[model samples]
Target: MPKQKGPIPITGTVKNTTYFSLNGQYYERRKSSLTAAVVATDPAFAASRRCNTVFATAVAIARTIYPQLPTHKRIAGAFGQLTGRVYQMVLKGMDADSIVTAILGE
Candidate 1:
């Protein structure tokens, strides 16, 4: 992936900001207080949060399942690719459980 010139600018006020980068895409800064309200009232936000949770869990599981791998960079790169593919499959209406099971060879 190509590097960006700088951090992507986000519009609007946010509090308790945290930054996350996935597959070269940076997530928007989150406001902790407003996040609770948005999660409660927004279907899209809820789905996105659920998806992030699932991917985070899957990355942890993958680390355990493939513990013998060498190097932190390699492990992170592999999981990053795995997460992106799994996310795409999920977005395409595929079952995430099946995708993870297949990836884990379980």
Candidate 2:
């Protein structure tokens, strides 16, 4: 049974809880069990597949030119920004080589 310390309160872990808030609420977080295979093969995760495709394409381009980028404590931040912008372009069905040219000016 849940330990209810106040009116309209439900507390305590029952099962499969990933996260919970002390403000009289609970959240089930899927911290594990979601593998790449699950995302790729599950028909229910079609949206995830599409999103992943866009981001992957962006990262592929970013990686090819990453070593040429200036180094810094927050170097990954620039990579992230590049990936995000490229992701949007990919979602719009832009060509890969054109994306490289647009981002790198070459």
Candidate 3:
């Protein structure tokens, strides 16, 4: 990655409201949720209640940017999906927002 940019500033009240709604659900769904994904990827990322809070917040940000994703399917599974090599290559060089835009459209 070159230099990652700050999050795009959504425009107008409509966009703001839309983002709020999407973010709210994303936060709620994963608030108390934890997965082996974090544990395996970041050893410093301990599996604790606080970790879930941060994970939920991260999930919320991802969801707000990619509202089309199915909430249930967003969580990691017994067999990881996006964490795999294929998914990584497909999304290579793309920031999360760009990836969401490519996958889910505007």
Every candidate's lDDT: 0.59, 0.69, 0.43
Best-fitting candidate, measured by lDDT? 2
**lDDT tens digits, residue span 15-99, model 3:** 2132222432321111224457866676576466455654444454454544356576566551233334224533354455655
Q: Residue-wise lDDT of candidate 2 within 1-106, one digit each (tens)?
A: 2433454434344565444455556444444667789978999999987877778888997776566555652354787887788888888888888877787673
Per-prediction CA RMSD (Å): 9.4, 6.9, 18.6
User: For this target, which candidate reaches the highest TM-score against the unseen true structure?
Assistant: 2
| Residue pairs with backbone overlap in model 2 | none
| Collision count of model 3 | 0
Off by over 4 Å in 3: 1-68, 71-79, 85-91
Cα lDDT, model 2, residue 63: 76
Q: Is candidate 1 or candidate 3 better by TM-score?
A: 1
- Cα error, residue 42 of model 2, in Å, equals 3.4
Model 2 spans with C-alpha error above 4 angstroms: 1-38, 69-76
